[model samples]
Target: MAERVNRLNDLTPREWIRFQKSWFIHNPPPREPGVLVHPGKFPEGLAREFIEFFTKRGQSVLDPMAGTGSALVAAVRSGRQALGIELNPDFARLAEQRVQAERLALGDQAPQARVHVADARQLDQLELPPVDYCLTSPPYWDMLRQPGFETQRQRREDGLPTTYSDDPRDLANIADYARFLDELVAIYVKLHACLRPGAYLTVVVKNVKKGKRMYPLAWDLGRRLGETYLLKDERLWLQDNVRLAPYGMFNAWVSNTHHHYCLNFRRE
Candidate 1:
């Protein structure tokens, strides 16, 4: 008989059961001023959790929309090879610097981390090995351009960009929502070719709110990508640390959305 293979998460049965819960909380650590410049930055700790759950040590991980290198840093710290692609040169440089710093702190034994200054739409053209897993967070459709967001106003006051980048190619800059979603989905479809069979892909995203209209970005992507890959399940990442604001209060009900959907998919 063939030798039984070991295919399991790097967690005990009890620990794995805990992670299987539908929802969990993750209040990110306070970001330094330098890293805080990015408008939308996920936590490295959160990325590490997903990386460790999906990939084994020394496996390759890819983040096509690597913002500030959070996923890459998590991969390196987890002793996995990582590659990141970013469209903005400044953010790509910052990601590279952060990855280098992480490598230095991790000593010479850690696996490699590389950040490429390129568009995620052109992922197929890049020379990358078949990745064991992919984790990324795409832009939430042009909502940053709306003036009603107080956080965006505050960022503008602080001399930081309210949107991701000025590049016309940036999906976040696309005004039409349908066009943006189509393009973004196309990019993911292109990336599908680079994943090893049975590898998992995780997309951390939230629905968008624009002028009292809710766009179901997460649900939309889930349905769209389901056509190509097996839609595994969704894990909620809740944030209780954000202060509550009375949005549309006394006029209409608007809950402060403090969670993101971690959409999981498997390459069949």
Candidate 2:
């Protein structure tokens, strides 16, 4: 039998217990004006929690789908080296600017944060070091393109793009759910090559809703990726701050889904 080593070098027993809880509340800070252009940005505070738990100081963390550098910033703030690859040139530059600001603020002690402009599908082509941990949030399928979403409507009115990028390479732009999942899973499979042995990969995602049908995106990813890596468990991220609207009122039963699955996997 192979020996099982403890991976929780940086976390205390109490902290481990806290993270083990099935669900927790995380209301992200108001999106900074600069990053508001990326409609699906995750919270830096949330990213920090995962980074700190999974890695020790000076270890490297990677975000393959870094949108405006939330994961990179969080990794640096948590005293870990950071790398992010963004597909959109505009978003990649914005992420670089944000990382630069973070480094400047940290002065001499700032950990390295590098944001690369590249397609996540071509992760192997990039010169990346073996990462200790990965924390990222992929786009929730093609939900950004749906016209009925209030957030999408607001972004469209503000002259921002409703989708991630106009480029066809952007996974969010894929209209077909199955094709999107295949491409996304392929990206993760490539990402698995970059992780050190026993390292953790945390993906923050939510099941998507299009028209009247609900797609089990998070569940599907968990099932597919589980074949490649050990499915450790999942933590639910509940959002209490967002204003809830009646998604399907009167005729059908549609509850507001205010939670996201923080799927954790380990490379064995």
TM-scores across all candidates? Answer: 0.96, 0.95
Per-candidate local distance difference test: 0.90, 0.91
User: What TM-score number comes out for model 2?
Assistant: 0.95
lDDT of 2 by residue, 88-196 (tens): 9988999999988888999999999898899999999996999999999999998888888888888778998777888899998899999999999999999999999
Give the Cα error of residue 59 in candidate 1, in Å: 0.4
Whole-model lDDT, candidate 2? 0.91
Lowest-scoring 10 consecutive residues by lDDT in candidate 1? 3-12
Clashing pairs in 2: none
